[model samples]
Each structure stands twice: as structure tokens, then as C-alpha cells.
Target: MPSSDDVYSQLKDCVSEITKIPRGEITLNDSLSGDYGYKDGPSRRSFAISLERCFKKHGMTIPKKLDRDKMEEAKKLKNVRDIVFTAFGV
Candidate 1:
């Protein structure tokens, strides 16, 4: 199995590609809204979808509630490390 670090790195790469954010620009402290500017509902929803897709690619799944919440909770999901920790339980 891939280490947590490796999984996080892959997630970061996927997020960078999906969001069009540079890999170096993303960090464990960055937020989806405050840092990445995913302010609108549509943008947030798209972000949530992208995150789900990334998790699926890694053989993980987040709660369906994430979708129902309009991805509002995802705003708290700062950085790649948080994403990996949440999805993989690492």
C-alpha cells in the first residue's frame, strides 16, 4: 500500500490539475475559499466533486453528506494533508 505521504502527494497533484492551481502554490495551510477563492456555490460544488473523484481514484470515499451540504464543510478542508487525513483516516 502507498504511504500516507504518497497518497497526499497524489491528491495534491490531482487537486492542482483539477483546480488549475500550481502544485507549489498549494499548501497545508491554504483554504478552499480564503486561499483558492472557491467562493460561489457552483465553484464549491465543483470542488467537492473533484475531491470526491480524487478520493475514488485512491479507493476511498467520503460521506454523502458532503454533497448534501453543498460542500460548505469542504471550505474547512484546508490543504492536501487535511484532505488525505480525512479521506484515508491517517
Candidate 2:
């Protein structure tokens, strides 16, 4: 199993791809929109879908509850770390 740090790294990489922000410049606490350019609900929703795929690609499984439509469930994940923790545990 991958460690939490590895998971975080994967997530960071994905966000970097989407936002073009350097991974080193992003912190786990940075909000998806406020900080990293996921500026709206649709984008966040898309991100959630991409995240599900990302986890799958890495042989991980994101719980269904955390992956909800329109980002309803994921909205509470106000930052990168919160998303990872909610998906994989902290």
C-alpha cells in the first residue's frame, strides 16, 4: 500500500497538471479554488471525477461517499490535504 505522503504527492501532481502550479508551491491546506484555480463548482466536480480516476490508476480506491456529484460531498474538503484525508484517511 502506498503511504499517505505518496497519496498526497499523487494528488498534488494532479492538481499541478490541472492548475499549472508547481507542486512545491502548493500546500495541503490550500483551497482548490481560492488558491489553486479550481474556481467553481463545475471545475471542482470535474476534479473529483479526475481524482477518482487518478486513485484508480494508482491502484487505490476513493470511497464512493467522498466522490459525489456536483462536489456536494467534497465541498467540505476545503483544501488539498482535507481531500486526501477524507479519501484515504490521515
Candidate 1 residues 1-90, lDDT tens each? 456777677767777877788999877667777777887777877776787777677665543323425365566445435544555656
Give the Å error, residue 60, model 1. 7.8
Enumerate residue pairs that collide in model 2: none
**Superposed Cα RMSD, model 2:** 3.3
lDDT of 2 by residue, 1-90 (tens): 557777777777766766788878866567665674667777777777777777777677765544444363343334535655666766
What does the lDDT read for residue 77 in candidate 1?
A: 46
Estimate every model's Cα lDDT from 0 to 1.
Answer: 0.65, 0.64
TM-scores, all candidates, are: 0.61, 0.63
For model 1, the local distance difference test gives 0.65
Residue 25, model 1: lDDT of 82
